[model samples]
Target: LGLASCKNNTETLGSPLPLNKNYFENYLNARYNEEADYDPNSPANILREVHGLNKQGKLITQVSMFANRYPSEDALKLFGANEGVGAQLPQ
Candidate 1:
């Protein structure tokens, strides 16, 4: 992540999106105590797998797929749990 100049005096900084990937990996590693089986349906797995790709579009797509596969309430709960309160999944 790098800083960039914006039109205004305020500057734009690189996003800390990769932190989500790191957090997911750490959670899985700790929970499983070893390499966990790859679960495509798992949001953590999706984030971990896509982390290296460094493509925001791809990451968003994977998250969308995960949300689509589950009920809205379940998805929202899972998202909020991982991403913190009031974090809304894309519609």
Candidate 2:
């Protein structure tokens, strides 16, 4: 019964989304200087940095939510992806 319940729960959750490689790459490029000591390719390192930053009491504003919701190429380009990491968003 326990095993069946677990299977049902897993089925309900469905599969996780695939990692957005472009987002990761662009994010890495932008934050590389800020995390120079850690290996950008290491998932553990990336998670650690992100978690650390989040723990610093970062608040989620509406603009951030909007950016996350539309992280496609067009959105990224609008944020100056061509200008490289840490580029300022268009006014």
Q: Count backbone overlaps in model 2.
A: 1
Best by TM-score: 2
Per-candidate Cα lDDT values, in order, are 0.43, 0.45
Alpha-carbon shift of residue 49 in model 2 (angstroms): 41
| TM-score for all models, in order of appearance | 0.16, 0.18
Question: Per-residue lDDT tens digits of candidate 1, residues 1-91?
Answer: 9988676453433333323444455555543122334446566656766785432222211121221233344444554343433464665
Q: For residues 8-75, could you state the per-residue lDDT of candidate 2 as single tens digits?
A: 23333243333466765655554211222434556665676777742222233222122344356545
- List the pairs of residues colliding in candidate 2: 30-85
Q: Worst 10-residue stretch by lDDT in candidate 2?
A: 57-66
